[model samples]
Target: MSILLYFTIVPLGTAFLVTLLRKKKGISDLLAVLSSLYLFGLSLATAGLTKSHGVMIYKVGGWFPTIGITLVVDGLSAFLLVAINLVAFLVLIYAISYMERYTDKWKFHALFMFMLAGLNGVIISGDLFNLYVFLEIASISAYALVAFGVKPQNLEAAFKYTIMGAVASIFILLGIALLYSYTSTLNMADVAYCLSDKAKNPLLVFIWVLFLAGFGLKAALVPFHAWLPDAHSSAPSPVSAMLSGVVIKTIGIYALMRIFFNVLGVSINLLSVLMASGILSMVVGAFLAIAQNDIKRMLAYSSISQVGYIIFALGVGTPLAILGGLFHLFNHAVFKSLLFLDAGAIEYSTGERNMDKLGGLNNKLPVTGYTSLMAAMSISGIPPLAGFWSKLIIIVAAVEAGYIGYAIVAVLISIVTLVYYLKFQSFVFFGKLDAVYNKIQEVPLAMKTALVILAVICVMGGLMLTGTFRPFLEGASNVILSGTGYKQAVLGAIR
Candidate 1:
């Protein structure tokens, strides 16, 4: 239980400090930064421990067998916790300076930390009901974060996001109620164990549909993705980076993967559904992004497309495909965040985001321009970059799995991904300097630092699949591949 307490306490503590010392902005910033940094350290330490000791389980209230909640930190959960905290720490530091343009920076920081706590909680919770509660904690905070700018579009986006989120939550809760009624257990392992006794429950089929729709909304999968562009683009950039970078993965794909593959048991039919959704996202996201003039809007749509690739790979159900999907998830987190932060830096410097009005940024803001270019090329799947390696893995997985049609679609979508990134690069930073932007200054130092960190990661993320990090990624993927067999690992730990 120390694991859960440690992760949640740091953020909740920082929030208290923010509330108590509202007037001391500098002090609050320092406290918030330190809190996030400490949390990141905790996540890293957790990673190392999990590497050495394997899955760590903390039975809440010392209750055994199904009475209280359980927080299980396995390879997969540990990996995501580390990823979420890692980016959140950088984004928090970026927010310290980037948020200066707006008022009430401390409020932003507090809410941000709370949001992180909720995300970590969602990733670690081993019970369905507890997972829902943490999902709410993160979703509610996200709703407020979306409206932080207080612009009409911001408010509108937040309202839409909230309403959709509510609908999704209701669906999820209803499904949980159904499952609880059927199995009388909220703990995932208990439910799975009980489920294995029943050959296949019809109620489970219904619950599966509910979960797909509910988590689909969170993931911004194609049909359920209406509010993402407005909300992500309008929110402050750090929030945008976090939203696209890791939030969707945690709340949507990661949750879906866990419940389906580990808890409910994966089936060929479900894999088909996953692949179809993935393909739709890839094609549609790429096509729509090519038409947007707003810099952030375009990038938001692109995320929808790229995420499809990961979903599709996982759906393919081959070991190679799952590896590719997981790898892409990690790489996308880095480059996509960097891209959004780069957009933020542009807005900070020039106060403009329209591609039509942006030009010649390389001359005026060399760091932002160069860093963004690295991100663009990396995201576009240029050779030697992380994106290229992951994409190669996915395509190879598709071809080797004999999903030749999907492989063709994957290659085509990648080409499309490149087209848009090149368009973004040429239009925003490489052409004649927009005459109107002559007086613009470079991005604030803190923002530049975050961008640089992400850019370097974008370049090096591929290395993760090759060295010591290779085991980390493979181990986490193996947990998912464990499928219903996951019970063996958890049950063994409990014994």
Candidate 2:
């Protein structure tokens, strides 16, 4: 219970205190930083405990079994905890320096902390309705954070995101209601258990459609991805890192995998649909991105493309394919966040995100230039970098699963990916220096620290595919692999 309460307490506590004294402007940054550090520590402690033992269950208000809202710390939760908290800690470090340009640093930190709480809560929660609650928490904070800049574009993007997100939430809620009505249980595993032997209902297909629509919007997959570029590119950099990095994975793709694989039990038809969409997103996103001059906008389009690879891998549904998909998910989270943060750093220094307006920064903004280069290479699947190994596995798995066409497409996109990245590097950092950026300096220490740490992770994240690190990706994959046994795993672990 302490573990679950930590989520509620830390963010609520921080939010309350921040709101009360935010007007003071004194000691707010210190308090904000301290609160985030503490939350990071808590998540780490939770991770160590889960890795050492097995799942940890906390039932709220003394309710037992399927009757209560339960927070479960199984392999899936633990893996997300590490990824979310790890990125968050680095984002916080970056925010310390990155947020200096924005006013009301305290309020910014407060919103950031609340966002983390919502994300963590969404990951750990075992109850379907509770997941909705946490999803809203994260989404609402995100809506505000996207508009944190209060610029016309920021507000417009935030408005668009809010409307789309609200629609998605309604779809999810309606699906939950249908599930609750059919199974008479709000608990996920319990619903799965009750459904384990139940005859197929036509309602399931309907529910699947609803879920696909909802989470697809959340994940920003191709057709549903229209909102992502505008929103992600408009938000502040640290917020951009968080949104592109963890929020979409936790609230969107992660939930989709959990429900489709574990709870709903997807069919071959479902997988075919998944693979087709993945391929479409991969090709379309990459093609569109190559023409963009807005660096952040380009990255946003690239995100859609990369995320397609994960979905395609998952659609293959092979062990190695799932491994590749999950590996790519984590690897993408690390380097993508670094890229966004680096973008933020450059924007902070020069107040420009237009690639054509900037150049020759390799010398002046060494930290931003090199770190972003590493992230670009990692994302483009350069050898020995994190992106290459996961991508290799995904392509291999696609071939293994007899999707040679998909494999060919994935490979081609890798080349396309490299092309756009080179274009970004050439236009943003390698060409002649822009006269408007002459006096820019390196970002503050805290932001630099964030970039360096994430760059190191980008260099080494491929190690996650290896022996000791295998458990993180593998254990999380097994949770989905054992989708058939999912009901048993959760029901058996009940108090």
Candidate 3:
């Protein structure tokens, strides 16, 4: 069970070690990439182990739940671990070459590892206070990373992100405090066990509202999404990939799901609220994306829209719907990360992010062009790609749940998604090559390697719903479906 600690410790330690080795040439890169690779492999192994071993629990210093910090690696934890570490590893690889334009590349490596550590901790931590702590760690690192360029826009974006992130943290802390005062414990499983026995009241209702607002802000759901586009577009491309692909999912959606479904328990009212928010985010985000000329900004807005599918599916509260949500979560991480990296490569080669200023890159940057095309298609829900299947499942599940109106809106949004992505491909890759960019070369091998692997995943990702890969997603969905029974699983695992 101590293996859970490695996910946190290695990255945190590597972060510190990278800081010390900042002056050494290449050492920081080596350590950061190696640590990320190890964590990715370990996460994959943990996924396998959890599927075979059931839930595993680790108590710090031999203390029991409610008495000490506990770490758990259930199906959900392992599933997220794999997604987070895999994306981190790939982003680290992409950053190796992409970050050369900046000074103090080692600092980026350090902060990235810190964020990775925090993300892993958020998934594995068994208590609410620790979850908040880990969330802050990740949030703070992200704020700084967004400003890594120190450009005026980057500074402004980071400041806005810091302010919004602080507000969200405060909301989450206040909710945790109220929950603790009522239940007399912070261990999530114990809190759930306690809450299950108590009658619902006004204070609990207030707690739910607070937590939803807090996590909703972090997740950048509609009305709460002001910070995401700027923060994501201003950050380095690899950082953008991490932010849109895994960070929001981890500290935002993942936290929301863990608390609402497993610890606090879900209700019809809560589910309806989620559904409404999801639809709003979907429509608003897609329309905004269609209006963007900046490539990274468009992708950032697109992320908010794609995330809506996941949120809406989860809100549907059906078994098939939960499975669809989780599947789309995983698929979004892959294709979105790939799309951002492709954007970075284009910028790296031509120093242009405005789609209108770009054209005919297909022949010159074949790798970037084709990969971007694949990712754009996947995100647009084109058939036979990973994104299509997840979106299909979500739409099908929505109809099955008798939310025919929601399903219709989802289908409409998917069409809008395809529209903007076609705009992306047309303006950037399919037209006449700009004379200024004619001499620009493809990105370095490292960036292309990251893009190609992710593209391959986008192509093959549909297979996840079949064969051995299905269990990884199913296991995670089963955890959410289990609801308050999560407490019994954790406590029983401890025994």
lDDT of 3: 0.95
How would you encode candidate 1's per-residue C-alpha lDDT over 1-495 as one tens digit per residue?
Answer: 376568877898898889789897587789888988998899888888888878788887788847788888888888888889989988988888998888988888888888888899888888999999989988999999999999999999999999998999899999899989988999898888889998776778899999999999999999998988988998999999999999999998889998999998989999999999999999999999999999999999999999999999999988888888888898888888888999999999998899988888998999999888988888789999999999999999999989999999999999998999899989988879967888988888888888898889888888988978988888788889989877777777887
Show pairs that collide, candidate 1. none
Off by over 4 Å in 3: none
Residue 285 Cα positional deviation in candidate 1, in Å, after optimal superposition: 0.6
Rank the models by lDDT, top first: 3, 1, 2
Instruction: Please give the RMSD to the true structure for each candidate, in Å.
Output: 1.0, 1.4, 0.6
Ranking by TM-score: 3, 1, 2
Q: Write one digit per residue (lDDT tens) for candidate 2, span 367-486.
A: 889999999999999999999999999999999889998899999999999999999899888978877778889988988998999999999988887887887778788888888577
lDDT of each: 0.89, 0.88, 0.95
Where in model 1 is the C-alpha error above 4 Å?
A: none
Q: Candidate 3's residue-wise lDDT over 376-407, tens digit each? A: 99999999999999999999999999999999
Winner by TM-score between candidate 2 and candidate 1? 1
